[model samples]
Every structure is written in structure tokens, then in C-alpha cells.
Target: MKKIILTIIYILTLSGCGLEQGSYLVGWWNGDIPTKLSDKEEKIWDICREKTKYLPKNTEEEKEKADMELNNCLHEKGFWD
Candidate 1:
């Protein structure tokens, strides 16, 4: 059935599920990836804030970058790992 085929494809895709940086320690490299995160994902959020602290003031681009930065900063120095 079409449904069965779609399900198989979905499973295959998720089988390789991974965040941007590929791993947590490597998180800082991408600035928009979260790898090896734990239950305390909040900790990584804080670290992202610190890493992007020096970025420019309020702006769409800055906000977008911050969001992406958070994706990768979660496991750097916070309790997320």
C-alpha cells in the first residue's frame, strides 16, 4: 500500500536522525545544530545566549542567527550535556 511504502521511507529517514553539528562538543562549529543533548536542554539554551552575546542589536537577521546559534550551542558549556 502507499501508506506502507511511505512509512518505510519515513523510518529510513529517521534512522539517521542527527542534529547539525553531528555531535555536542562539535556543536559550536555549526551555530545551528543541537547534538548529544540531554533532558536539561534548557542549559544549552543559556550557553547559546552567551556565545551570541556579542552579536548586533535587535534585527531580523540577528534573531534568525540567534535561533540557529541555539541549535548548536546547547551542549557547549551548559548543564545540557
Candidate 2:
């Protein structure tokens, strides 16, 4: 009985059966983060590197929004002709 219960618990934990969508586990599993920069991306990265160092003190949500805006700007100007 103990082995059976432990096995069931282990499977449930591994499956993330009851986890919320916004949990950190979900974010990590989604892998939306960029890990490397292409040449073009590097150019945009250089252009934005200074801005990244100077982000203003703000709430977490506001900072995330600012980062998203910066990423959108980089995408628009870097890849779009």
C-alpha cells in the first residue's frame, strides 16, 4: 500500500496535474526565453543594451511591460524591413 501510494504521488507531481497556468513551472516549461543572439539580434541587443542598464525603479508588472515593449521594438526594427 505504501509503495502504491508513493508511486501515485510521484506520478501526480511529475505530471503537474493540478498546477496553475501562471505558475513558474509553466513558464519554465514553455521556454519562451531567448538563449542566444543572432547577428541581427545582436545589433538590436547592442542598441538596447544601454537602455537595459538604466531601467527606472518601478513595480514588477510595470517593469515587465517595459521589457515587453523593448522586445517588441527590437523585433520591429531589427527584423522588419
Candidate 3:
């Protein structure tokens, strides 16, 4: 199961699908096929999607904080085990 998931990730990553988007989708799959995002997950996805827009304007410390917050958000939402 892990291998299959990893393979899919690898393929998606290499297919120019955007690693962040691919990883988010794969993690949210929760071992089943992913067909849609829940409301909460969609909110997180929106944040991630807009990150690049604001991240570059942030200072190093701000960026670090934002990254940590995002990581925590993902973990709290079960983006990964």
C-alpha cells in the first residue's frame, strides 16, 4: 500500500502536477481513492494555494512562522500520520 501510494506520488510529482498540490491530494486520500475535498480540507488547500502570493513578501522569521503554522495545520487535519 505504501509502495503504491509512493509510486503515485512519484508519478504525480514528475508529471508537473505541482508537488504541494499532489502531496495534499495524496495525503488526504487516506489510503482510499481521493474524489473530493471536505470543507475543512478545502480551506487548508485554499491557504496553501495562496501561500506563494504572500510568502515572498514576508520576512525570514515571518516565513518560518507561516511555514510552521501550515505544517501544524496539516498535521492537525491529518494530512499525514
Candidate 4:
């Protein structure tokens, strides 16, 4: 019975799984400074990169968005330029 209960808990946990949408964008926003990213942000970036591999190639607009995000991240990191 204990084993069954443990299995049920595990299954429940797994069922809550969901990917971070905009994670890559967030990562791109959070500058590339080694100390800038929290552990969670880094993980989100990795997941975004992996997931975006299946997305259609980025358009110019997408590229612009990425640049904007990167700039935001840099600004947050105290970069003025």
C-alpha cells in the first residue's frame, strides 16, 4: 500500500509538468553575465533553446524581439550602452 501511494504521488507530480513559454526570451533578456542569471533563469533558457528548435525559423520580427529582450537584460544588469 505504501508503494502504491508513492507511485500515485509521483504520477501526480509528473502530471503537473509544463514548459515555460517565453523562457528563451527571458533568458535573452537576462543578459549573458555569468552572475546575472538565477538558477531558475538559466534552466528556463536551456528549456527555451531546446523547445525553440522545433519552432519555425525565426523571422526578422522575432530577431528584433530577441534583440530587445537582450537589451533589456543588459540594462537590468546595469549596462548603459
- Per-residue CA lDDT of candidate 2, range 3-81, in tens? 9999999998888877878777777789854356778877877776665647663898878877876787677676443
Model 2 gets an lDDT of 0.74
Stretches > 4 Å off in candidate 2: 11-28, 31-35, 79-81
TM-score each candidate.
Answer: 0.32, 0.45, 0.35, 0.29
lDDT of each: 0.66, 0.74, 0.68, 0.60
* Model 4 stretches astray by more than 4 angstroms: 1-57
Q: Pick the candidate with the highest lDDT.
A: 2
For residue 43, what is the lDDT in candidate 2? 82
Error of 4 at 3 (Å): 94
Ranking by TM-score: 2, 3, 1, 4
Clashing pairs in 1: 33-71, 33-72, 44-74
- Show the lowest summed lDDT stretch of 10 residues, model 4: 48-57
RMSD after Cα superposition, model 3? 10.8
Comparing candidate 3 with candidate 4, which one achieves the higher lDDT? 3
| lDDT measured at residue 44 in model 4 versus the true structure, 0 to 100 | 58
Q: What's model 3's TM-score?
A: 0.35
Return the TM-score for candidate 4, rounded to 2 decimals.
Answer: 0.29
lDDT of 3: 0.68
Residue pairs with backbone atoms closer than 3 Å in model 3 (clashes): none
Instruction: Name model 1 segments beyond 4 Å from true.
Output: 1-43, 75-81
State the lDDT of candidate 4 residue by residue for 1-81, as single tens digits. Answer: 999999999997886455354455445556632356676666655555554445443798877666666656555544442
lDDT, candidate 4, at 10: 96
